[model samples]
Target: MFKVPPRPSTSRIPYAPLPNQGNDSGATPKASSPARSHRSSSGSCFETPVAAPSSSRRLSYAVNSGIKPSRPSSVSKGRSSIVAPAYSNLSSAKKPGEDPRPLKDKAYQADCIQNIYAFLESRGFDKPFDAGMLQLPSSKLFLKIFEFVMKQIDPRFKYGNKPEDDILDFVKGLHYPYNLSRSSLQQAGTPHTWPPLLAMLNWLVQTINFSDATSGPGTTAAQPAHLTPRRFEAGPLTNLTSETSPLDEEGCRAVFFEFMKESYNVFMNTEDETISDAKSQEMMQLFTTYFEEARQEVALDVENLKTELSRKEATLERMQDKSELKKLQEDKEILEKLLSDLIKETQRGEKDLQGYEEVLLDKQQELKKCAEITAGIQEDNALLCKRIQEQRFSKDDIEHMEEKLARRKAVLQMLKENRMHAGKEASKVEIQKVKIMEEIGQAAKKFNQRAAR
Candidate 1:
């Protein structure tokens, strides 16, 4: 439902001669009557006012009076108070208003047209389009173009009885980014209302192009190359490879669906069995062509993948060998450094061991001397015991013997302290010697393991 402004009155309106609409003499037509002239002057008060062409009588009156009917100017200084009629049937007679919408840039329109045609051509659309088609497309041509575009988007999308409503619904469903009015789509045949439709189609074209580019083969979301449906494949037709051009999987599917639909319709509609048989043969031939093309494309892809895999495997083998060799060289250098450090440590240990050995020998000699002193003390005690047993004693002799015994005991205590100190020194020396031996043994074991490696 469209809301249109009221039509302006034509009474007392001026009739200005349009450019190149004058007589052969190049003279402007003058009003024959004073009333006509007065009316023309009175209409000049309004700025760029458009009057409805009421009937043929008004046009005849202007022609007989030698005054031309006014023609609307293509350009206007401001918003002209003229509006197109609501009904498309009266579109030719109606004057278009000064559109609030800005004109599309010519460069931008040309680019969009070019892109749309390029996309259509890529999709194998047979019909050609010029710039004029978008500028002032007929309803029939517009619908045809729309159907083609929608079919490209979805091969099985069928147009219903109200194609205009269907198209509007489909565009609305897509959430088209621009303003699209139902009125504009309803009167799509008119030049004044066709721009939005053209823009919508261009947008659809761009969307399809973007989707194809992003989701084509080799992308993560692309369909598997090898998944060709057997139902869509060629039947028993021969000479498959010679007849068809290469087709992608999607193309093959679309072609097969169309072929089947057409075949089914022909079979159901035709009363003649011979015609049905011929149509079936043609469908078979068409199917074989698409099937072969798709098959060839899949084969080529498989071969390319195989070659790529082999190349990668060869590269991996080379890299693995080089990496392993480099690792071995690094490990060998590490082992050599460890062996050199161990050798240095072994030499240091030997020096420390020699020093420890010398200390041990000194301790042993001290221990032996302490043992001899201990033995001498024991023998002296024995001799004193024997003397005590053999001789009677006076109190002065006994006191004298007690003093000697106390002095000997003091010597023996000094000897025992010396011996204990020597034993502690010996134990410390033994511990050091054992630690040195263990370290030497461990270093030797590591050196032997490295040699084996």
Candidate 2:
């Protein structure tokens, strides 16, 4: 999940990085391509062409070098322009004397260069020479030259009109010198043009070195051009005519050959750095990956530990629950034993209370009998007193007394009848009291009833 930008900084490489940090400073990236051992090799990363070389001049640059590179007055490729069909028609109205092919091609290259230059300028890109401290380096000069030459080949450059003076002005403004026209390059020998002239000389040396490798029309067994992806060529153009001005051919060739030598040195210095940078970036990513994996492992271990801890805790809780249950059972047994002892003591106490209640009941019956005997004695004493305290009576008193006695006898007979009726009511009340006493006795009876029986 770490993301690199559209174009990572030259100092760093995210994928397939160089060794020992981004020290690689070579303009051309190395070709790590495997040999195409088979045309139908399934492992090939790049597609196989149907034909190895279709035409003899498939990638040829055939133009004469006699004329100044034709330049349109003002190259405006895809610029803000209203296509005046009228003007095109008027220009087309020319009397069929001119070859518009070269014109169109020159115009296109100018436009392309202008666009590239404009784009580079707008983006704060220093021109080739200024980039290297106000003097164009050989590589930058070569790249520019390559771009210029490619314009003749790239069909897409044919979109504008510009003049050759415009190109000269562009060259003049360059911080480094390119040997074009001595007038354009030296500028009346103001002594300030030497630096650029020196830069042009540097390029010239490179051009000669490469030119030496190539045998021109005079030689046989010619060595092949150093054809790499970097060199702008479709294929070798042995028969191709050079369209560049003959005046400028030597300068261009000299510059090109000079760059080749410089390029050899530059590649030597920067290849190791680029490799080192790529390798360092790779290590950074690898370290990041290792750390992430370690974190995941740690997280997994933590989760496992937590799960194990929870299991142990659950077991502990179960043990605690069992212990509590055992304790509760023991308490329940103790309470049962205490309750049994208390119940036995309470039963004994209840038996003693019943015995006391029986004794009390017997005493109450004896007291009732004693009270009845005392009442009988008192009645007998009152009778004896009545007999002794009687007074003697005369015959008339005696007769009156006898008459009173007869009246008393009559009253006594009436009383005897009333007493008989009263005795029946008392007997009924006593029977009800005996029945209530029997109910009470039954209620009070317990094991004593069986014992008494």
Candidate 3:
């Protein structure tokens, strides 16, 4: 038996199998079946499993095939989106003799030509002939007309009195009816010269027309006869219109040049206005951006000021804390001095108490000796009383004995009271010594801790 490849797990997307080529009839597979049974070319039966492609792979395939994905069934009915048809059809016809531009471009060109012809007619270029018969004059006749037109247009232009001298210097210095060589015409840089030529003529036409229309009847009459408008013989112009004679096309091109020159001003003015509007808009946008940047900078400066203020406040607090610490140190020093003084006083008091104790002990010893003497004297007195009872004595002797006994009794009583007073003074001195020692101990402990810190 042939082993089939194991299917991928649930997370992985499987590659879809192509439909059978042997079966000409197209029928979709059933979803209810797990696998479809197929017969191989060798007539062996095998099962082929169908697996759905992943959404990501399907989207990638659609993108590669230049197809857009459809919305979900909830948004739109459960159907795949249809593709839009591309516009590929183009016209094939060609005119026999014409510029190969679109119909819209040709129409625009025609309108421009008509406007030029209208402007020429209105300016009396075809004064001698009817308005419909506008045409070019011969070179000789053209020179006369050119001189006359220039004299009317510019009051400063000087002309020759003699006929022979009229054509003199005509060919010199950027003169009109400019030379057109094949090489000059073929150069890429030559076309730029035409617009300036047209602009100059356009300015001239406007100046001339404005002077004429605004001129009073008295001013018109004062003008020279040659400058005055006049009709011309139609001989050269008639010849230009006929196809029989073969005059150079340049003469005819000159007529169109004059016509176009008059019409150029309108379009130039419109373009200038558009350009100025665009420039103004750009300036406004730049100003707005600068204002926003200025506002942002101001906000940043405010934040910096706030931070600086906070720092200053913190520094002030630290300084205050340092001053407080200095005060505490001063107080500690004062307390240490007081404790040292107390300890010195305690030492002196201990010394004084020791001297007092010695004095008190000496007094106690004296009192004991005095008490022994007093007891012996009392025994002698008792013996004297017995002797008086045995043998009668003088009254003077008895009186003297009584006086001596009273004196000894008074001395003994004073010694006993002095001993008691000394004992109380010694106990008080000891209590004061203990208190001073405790104070000194506490002060020393505090001083050591401060030194360690």
The candidate scoring highest on TM-score is 1
lDDT tens readout by residue for model 2, 141-254: 534543342232232323223223433422322211223554434242233443333333323222222233432331213223332111121121223223332224453353
What local lDDT does model 3 show for residue 253?
Answer: 37
Cα RMSD for predicted model 3 = 54.9
TM-score of each: 0.27, 0.16, 0.16
Instruction: Write down the lDDT of every candidate, Cα atoms only.
Output: 0.52, 0.40, 0.39
Q: Write the per-residue lDDT of candidate 3 for residues 251-270, one digit (tens) a residue.
A: 33332232222222121122
By TM-score, highest first, what's the ranking? 1, 3, 2
* Higher-ranked by TM-score: 1 or 2: 1
Tell me how far the alpha carbon of residue 64 in candidate 1 is from the true structure, in angstroms, after superposition. 64
Segments in model 3 whose C-alpha atoms lie over 4 Å from true places: 1-321, 390-453
Q: Name the better of 1 and 3 by TM-score.
A: 1
Cα displacement (Å) at residue 151, model 3:
99
